[model samples]
Target: MSEQAPLVSVIVPNYNYAASLELCLRALQAQTYAPIELLVVDDHSTDDSVAVARRLGVRVVQTERNMGVAGARNLGVAHAGGEILVFVDSDVAAYPDAVEVAVAMLAADPRLGAVSSIHDPEPLIRDSLVEDYRALQYYYWTASSEGSISFLFPALVAMPRRVYDEIGPFNTQLRETEEVDYGHRLTQRYDMVLTSAVRSRHDHDDRLGKLLRKLYRRGRARVPLYAQRRRFACGFETSSRAGGSLAALAALAALPVAAPLGPAGAMLPAAALAVSIIADLGMYRFVLRRRGPLFLLYFGVVHFVVNVTIAAGVAAGVVRWLFSARFRRLYEPDLHVRPSAAGEAAT
Candidate 1:
């Protein structure tokens, strides 16, 4: 007889995303991996998400109250029967081979605690300018050299049961940047890989406003995240990106102030801004080469908006963190660990 494959539990935590939930479920059902259990944990979604899960014949675990994504995922882990846990967002549709590839990679390397698929935006990028920018950004970020990765989005990630148990659960208090926190914890013990071999389609918000809001929320969450993991403060994930954006915005803001001084003063800030844009373009040269000059028109505006909004959001988060004792308490790393009883139950 052949050795049995390990059971893989695919957990999807959803809110009011009924429209996209159906497609996400369908993709899970179509996964090539066998002995898979699909579980959808609903966080008191005020939509037809629960009904949709039930109609699809997948087990639905409804939280009594809104526990957010992190809490819902913890609840799912408690109820899971599989030895491997696969977390997929409601807006992501895994390719047929995604689970199989992730599982295979994890199986081949015992040290690999988790593996996240390359999120391809080709499927969702229609004629929308927002979509176009997102697609380009995704391409640039994920096209890095393969090996241990610093970040892993929960949108499509798989990990062994042991890894999750050891690392503990996601920080429920964090409505954003939870994945980064989790990834940081995982890297301390085991390795995480990002491979193009495994693919998934992420349905990003095509609306510019929605995208900016998302970035702002992510930026705000960074305050607490950075507070907990100080080593990551100057790391590529946070400081580099934020610093570059801030620099660009500062130069732009100085342009107006400098204009009143003299033409020479104005030229100084203008030169700085010009240098920043050129550096950004050079950094994303791969994108420019692939998408042609037309991409530059959209990228320039999108880059400015994203950086400016994120910087503002970070500022807001810092003020909130300073004023609210509750926020300060929540930023403590210990608050993120799974409780003893909950961890025991999950095991």
Candidate 2:
């Protein structure tokens, strides 16, 4: 927030997150950055999210239909008048200096197209064990991949309007993997950074089923993009990480098949499991150091299940890619991708 500060519009894309909307906005209200513009773009939420945004004295832009997060964000951008744009999800409570730090990073480096904040290893509100596990897992994944990256975490990220225009709006079709698509497009010419300099606390999935389903869909949805560019958005999504999931999945799939072969076959799955564990042994040790043995044990069990689910999702995506032309063409428009104009998906 230097003198002659440019306007920073913080666009919050919301969908039925009223439970945490107030916290999100209140934190924005207290940002250390000046000349800040905050708007909550509600994507046809059935909950009282709009009311909460209004009560907080923030502008609420309601979408004509359920346009998903990408659409909502595009609409928010359309209404934004700031030189700098910040996208903070409704479920994230950004710290006071989040905007200031992001703006500084962008200003300090002309090559920096986007600066994404890393969330704390805790939720905005303590809800369930699943939430805690997710927060910790996501934090470690991001924290371990700090500095220049190809990934763009939109939950708490900022970029100049010109850079956004150059990269273009997020793909409306990529509701689940828009960030992935955007990151690939952005990284082609500019640098994107993931830093603790701009921090936020996110309200991660509270239910085990919800967490698993989200990851599964994200894993599946990202196949077309990866198939096209084969890009690893960040160091976090490395081959070793994929190997972990695949190894875990191999163990699961081989268990029953190997049961018929008895003792010798059992060794196959055991070795796969060991390889999977070894793949992310650093993550396990990180959790162990922070949460101690008991929580680390629980974290490992949950993470194993998560890895299996992600691998299964990717497997399903591969099968669909081989069979369905449409699935293969999911990111076919990567060369010239843009979001619909502020309101609806292109028809």
Sequence-dependent TM-score of model 1: 0.89
Model 1 residue runs over 4 Å out of place are: 1-3, 123-127, 233-238, 321-325, 338-347
lDDT of 1 by residue, 1-347 (tens): 12599999999989998978999999999998988999998877899998898999988887777887888888888889899999998988899989988998899999999998777747443648787787667655565434567676688899999999999988887778778778888888988887778888877778889989998888877776676556562123545566667767677678778978897787777776665565465546766676777787677778777877877788888898889778767667777785323221211
Q: Which candidate leads the pack in TM-score?
A: 2
Clashing pairs in 1: none
lDDT of 2 by residue, 1-347 (tens): 46799999999999999999999999999998999988888898899998898888898888778988988888888889999999999999999999998998899999999999999998889899888899999998899999888878899999999998888888887878888888878998899999998989999989999989998998898788788786666756878899999999999989998899989989989999999999989889988998899999899899999999999889988888889998787787653466665454211
TM-score of decoy 2: 0.96
Model 2 CA RMSD to the hidden true structure, in angstroms = 2.3
lDDT of 1 at 207: 84
Query: What are the models' TM-scores?
Result: 0.89, 0.96
Residue 271, model 2, lDDT: 95
RMSD to true structure for each model, in Å: 3.4, 2.3
